[model samples]
Target: MQRRGFLKLGVGAAVVIGVAGAGVALIKPGLVDGKLGPGARDVMRAAAQAVLYDLLPPPGAARDAALALQLDRLDAFIASLPAPTRKELSDALGLLATAAGRFALVGLSRPWAEATVYEVHEALNAMRVSTSNTRQQIYHALRDLNVVAFFNSPDNWRSVGYPGPVQIP
Candidate 1:
């Protein structure tokens, strides 16, 4: 594409995403009062499952507990973020929770709650390689947030083969 055409596409993607974010926030409101509600948690859970599939335990009670812990950590981390950052995160999560947004942005036609780990993984991979910078940023935000939340707990370090931080005298 020509430089001007590319620039226009970029601007167009930004505007559409912003408008969708706002509309999703006002309509369904995945986050209640800037907190992760059921919808937000569902979105995060799906993405986390995809991004951390290898790191996560096999399906069972252990896996469920691990996911629960990660979600809890994510909630705490979001609570610590600045208002604007938290709002953006909320909006992003909210967008992912919507059917139209999920299909348009993540390329996932199925609901997050119903999507398999493999399906979610494919969707995320698609976003990561998309021509749209906006989609790449969204992928990073979703993946990185889950990575941070999963690794924030020292208890999870053994899973990733990290022996904990090096001791300094």
Candidate 2:
């Protein structure tokens, strides 16, 4: 586990990725496919970071809003992902959302907040443990989704006086 060896591994992985890209261009769509895109990965990472900030008790409006925007971008990204990968991500999100919704129904802000937070975190944990190529993407999705659930929660909205923004017809 020398530092030099680790660095070499990193370099090797990058080379592999570069070769894969060249191969993809040379090969046909039917031959092989990898749906995740760099832009989407960026969105996911940003979203995850935002959610981390928003989960604090007081909540973070700027971060939450940022995460929401990222989620919108993610929605588009998800569409481009392989169908199986999309389904996996969707299922994980659905679990988190369902837990959040149940907690919201009870008006238990604190627990709802906790459950929502944990669910997304758990999703990220699962993604990391799995062999999915989109582990990073899932991590991003979980992070963003949690922030969205938190900011949109009744408690956060009431605290912030976040009236739906004015319509701009």
Best by lDDT: 1
Off by over 4 Å in 1: 1-21
Error of 2 at 59 (Å): 5.4
lDDT of 2 by residue, 1-169 (tens): 9999999999998677546544542332211223323333332443355355444334477656755555554454555668776655544433223323222222223332344545544545665576646555555555555455556544556545787557999
lDDT for position 157 in model 2: 62
| Backbone N/Cα/C clashes per model | 0, 0
- The models' CA-based lDDT, in order, is 0.85, 0.47
Residue 96 local lDDT, model 2? 29
User: lDDT per residue, candidate 1, 1-169, as tens digits?
Assistant: 8999999999998798778767976676666765688888888899999999999889999889988888889888888889888877777777778887888888988888899999999999999999989789999988998999888888889987999989999
Give per-model TM-scores.
Answer: 0.86, 0.31
Model 1: lDDT to the true structure: 0.85
| Ten contiguous residues minimizing lDDT sum, candidate 2 | 99-108
TM-score of 1: 0.86
Model 1 residue pairs with clashes: none
